[model samples]
Target chain A: MYVAVKGGEKAIDNAHKYLAEERRGATDVAELSLSQISEQLSHAVSRVMAEGSLYDKDLAALAIKQARGDLIEAIFLIRAYRTTLPRFGYSAPLDTSEMDLDRRISATFKDLPGGQVLGPTFDYTHRLLDFALAAEGLEPQKAEAAEAPLDEEVPRVLELLNAEGLIEQSAPADYDDTAPVGDLTREPLEFPADRDLRLQNLARGDEGFILALGYSTQRGYARNHAFVGEVRLGDVTVEVIPEELGFAIEIGDITITECETVNQFQGSKTAPAQFTRGYGLAFGHSERKVISMALVDRALRCHELGEDQVAPVQDDEFVLSHSDNIQATGFVEHIKLPHYVDFQSELELVRRLRRNAEDNIREAAE
Target chain B: MALDSSPGDPSRKNWMGILARASETDLENFWQLHGQEEDYDFLRRPEIGLVMVQGRAGGTGGRFNLGEMTVTRCSVRLSDGTVGHAYIAGRNQRHAELAAAFDALLQNPERQEEIEDTVITPLQKRHQQGRDDRSKKAAATKVDFYTMVRGED
Candidate 1:
């Protein structure tokens, strides 16, 4: 009888060697630079940074190159690295009011304080693909802007709703004073999660997973009519106030896409009639992700706003608990690991069933 | 609660906490049986169970256990004046302790660095030593059987 093979170490070592060789294909050619990846494959970099939960452009670019441009692998690398980094201190919650926005647009109002400046968007671009870029060694020319900068702070759309008392006031008193928000990474997701936990899930949740969950709401599952109250793409300041310093220090700026959704909600006996909120904020320019997140967030608020828990997709506990792609991926991939013992038991049961059937057939014949 | 107590007290204050722990021991036992304690701990708390789940070299099934394991876990202090926990796989006690220390660190925000250096590093080294001990025992058990074959017509 052929016994089980036992050269796994050698096989794994050889596989690594082969992988290294494949990763560095065409050894004569110069390897792609991190700066090139960051600049050229910016969208991929953004996605990696967003999902990886690390905002460093250079490191993300390096991850992309190291993972052979596999965005998910790049994200995995970033996450692994992120887990290792020592938690020195946490910066206080960002004040978006002081954000120096590079690009800000409000879909709710046409003429806001900050007039809409269409900054580097593909909304008006022609459908035809540009073939001229394929030609080698062509130096790109910078396009000149025709319009002057509309330097005005766009009033928050939510603020407008609040002014009319149309939206529920998100007062600080609503949150628990003693028990603050806990990091989702540190703790296992529990059922009947609060808004903070749900938001945390949306923030770190896989784009595709959030997108699909968000889509379910629009397909009449949650029946939440979501309007993009505001979608602001800008550079938000990250302030670090050291214990020794005792004052807020401007560490750096990070690109963020913040989307706030307004959904219709009727006042029940216990709650007042108001517009519920679904907020989405992601690292880098992930508009689709942010918008989708907002929708999902609003749908999840059905129970909190004293509305009927009408849909499976709207259940805060279910959605928040099962939203993590990392957990899902790990469990799914673990199935590839050893299961022979389980398989053996299954095989024995099947054999016994077959023998019993054969005996019945023989008895009938006799 | 006395720091320098009589040996016979058994520490009821600490004992109640242990009792509380034993009450919820079913989950821990369930994990000990089916779940890879180290892997689960690693995800939850990196500092405690930093020992890697070294897969078997080769076997009938994919990545058999081969009755060998190394694990790291951490006991932590919760913010609510309660002790916390995390257990992980692997020899990185620093990983476990950092996770544990981080749990403690998150609660107080005062003694982050002290815990990092004092608790995390030593635990990591101990975890590695445990792995080394297991490997050494396995190595000592190694034996080879040989036979001289006689010429047969």
Candidate 2:
């Protein structure tokens, strides 16, 4: 039970003032601008956006600034701000196949349609610290441009396997857009959650948490022999068919990272052995997060695929309930918020019980 | 609000995509130069809202809610009664208003060619240039694997 204790109004106000001053840091240093955070610390902003479940880069950057670089705090701020805004509608499910490809690669196949394009990535970079970045006014070398541009559309690697029926199809044969999809934001997540709900949960799940869960699976805790089928990063146009407009109009584009994992699935008596699929998608270039999401996604699909649910990751309720960091942080951190009354009640009970026990022992002796 | 009688016009979709994706600064400059004198009334005032973004299960399967993105939408009716609607990403009120105003203006047959030339064309060029620059750089990074012949072979 929570009790509202009054008083300390002046102290609370002064504490906030001190916090503001502290947030400014040393006066000699130039202030960090929102643009700088949005541009330079973009990966941080992306994580906040992905976890916060909001897409406004500027607002995410501002939240990061307000939270003093505490990403979870920034995500909390974003989530809070999101609740206040009115919802317009839902966008058409993004067609990632038509995405303006920046980075596309496949681990399962060396050569595939729309040959591997390595866009801007740190995969090949040595992890040594570049002190040159610390000093300002350093002009970075420009990247070389190819004589000819890449193809407009690149086929997904999974599509190649789908052609030969070697891998299970990702979409249903009778997929319909009009069919209502489960939205956890609008409704509470119920048990026996479908793949849609699971994906949504993992999409916004805490990166580190999801990464750990995915890594555990790799260490033989429900290992599916996962192969990185494809990882693509680029901008995809978002379209919403406004009621008034009666036709779809592009709202804008958002950069996202998508991962598709091909897992080994031994066929049953009635079915033929074919590779299965796991999917992960998140806002911005969240490579690690998406990859983790894909692995967890596949693990949660054990029941559907007729596999034994022997691991924690295979349990949908456990993964989905604890995936959201905002929810997790609130329950964990609420203990710090004035639990004095509750503690006092417990203290009194303990003292009374101890006294009664001592008195009973003395009476017996007498 | 009256619906667009001919919603199947592909050009309208293309131009709207371009306008929605155009940078805020560029849109503002274009509006100031070509559309400052345009008269329109707000059917729906510029309001910030959320649009739930959905994604496919396996990039080709059933749909699922990914997350909500910030979108500002507005509706405007021109003096000549042509209605324009804008649903752009992000929370810029002025950007929505300007895009709606242009949409209404672009719908006018008399002014269509002129506005398309003066405003939309330049914006499209700038947008194309930015896309090409990034695509080219990415193209440069495409790996070309080569196999070396061993002396034993």
Candidate 3:
């Protein structure tokens, strides 16, 4: 191997070829298909969509395959692709109330109006891995359908608390026309973002960062008891109401997992104690991410609700500002960029200082 | 009215005529922007600024210098009880007002709809227009021209 190299472009191409061969494995075996990844490795696809901030399963699966199963790399691929796509018009927010019932459940009340539809969840399955799956001999079994029809809206569990005046009053819904906070992608994120924008950032934030922040809450960095008020996973139609159309046209259906957490909070002496809310919603069926998001959300509500701010996790501004994986990782990794100019300045200063010290030593010896 | 993503203020109306008829969407979408977050409450309460600067000193212990910057900050208690703090790098009254108004609107249950329609949309429009203009200007300056003489070979 030569100590000096000049064929950077050629080296890069060769390295890429080697990587591709390694990723594809043996020529004797058939290459993996995108469909297989989407079906069998759905969780990776979901994570990519959640972090990459895109909702297409096929694209996510392709990214995963192309990235050699690196979810973060897959997310980077989707994000890069998303940046190049031309922006059409904005679609109106999806109406969850009109969302076709898929999987709806309320932990507050076991048998609510919308009967708990387990949907496709790993909750009931034993932790033990099935050895038959390794041999590809097992067939998935479908569960029997329950007789009861689930309701359209499983009336939010918080409503029950609101009736008794036990929980925080629902913030008035009169602000529908408010412009959404500017995207951090277009511009940098300024501090003190509102709860809505902050939540959006957290939803699209890196999984590991949010997971760590959420873990801090459990470790008593901020103690807000979080109860999974609702965790629903299913498809929701994306509708765009074109000016000429005069009505919403269904773009497509996207699978989403929404988790809303009800947190226990003690109010100031002037006000009665109530359960505050921390909501988490993410694209695709990502219950783990959703649950993690909800916990972090609750922890961030300390200052807003007049609760004593005792933990780092309780700082809304800090958590929301720092939890973004893209920004955090980008800033952290950007140190690899050319810093030779600054390093050169330091190097000159060091040589001068060392020479001065050596001169002082020589003078003392004389 | 200005679009949500545009730069400069329509209310200030300083350069409104030049931007009014622009395709607001195109203007807003064309450029990259960076946002800075400042701790307004911390700055205003104590009336002091602590600016941190780090540099390598003699390739030994890293050196840190605390320089004072003229920082202006404000806090707004929105009608809905949400308080927003905005601190800018310099003493710009307009930036403070804009930040405060945005803060108020973000939390106002009553005026949110009106504020979005009247304020945010127009600002965004202006911002976008400026971005598009700059990008086009940059594109125009980009030259990738080369030539070779046929007889020389």
Q: Which candidate is the best by TM-score?
A: 2
Worst 10 residues of 2 chain A by lDDT: A169-178
Q: lDDT per model, in order?
A: 0.57, 0.91, 0.57
Model 3 lDDT tens row, A1-366: 113334578878999999999999899988989999999898898888878876667778899999999887788787777665434344445445444445656676665555555655576789898777777556776444433334435565656676888866545234333444345555666666555556667778877778788888887777787777777666554443433224433433456776777787677779878777776667777888877887887777666666788877777677777776666777878777567667778899999999999999999999
What is the lDDT, from 0 to 100, of the residue B133 in candidate 3?
Answer: 48
lDDT per residue (tens digit) for residues A1-366 in model 2: 668889999999999999989999999999999999999898999999999999999999999999999999999999999999999999999999988888999999987778888988899899999999899898977999987777886898998999999999887667676889999998999998999999999999999999999998999999998999999999999999988778888988999999999997678899898999999999998999999999999999999888999889999999999999999999999888898899999999999999999999999999
Docking class of 2: high
DockQ of 1: 0.01
Residue range B52-148, candidate 2, lDDT tens digits:
9999988989899999999999999877788888889998898898888888888877777898898888888988787888888889988898988
- Reference-based TM-score of each model: 0.66, 0.97, 0.64
TM-score of chain A of each: 0.90, 0.97, 0.87
- Regions of model 2 farther than 4 Å from truth: A173-176, B1-5
Better of 1 and 3 by lDDT: 1
User: What CA RMSD would you report for each candidate?
Assistant: 23.4, 1.6, 23.1
Task: Please tell me which model should have the higher TM-score, number 2 or number 3.
Answer: 2
Which candidate should be chosen as best, given DockQ against the real structure?
2
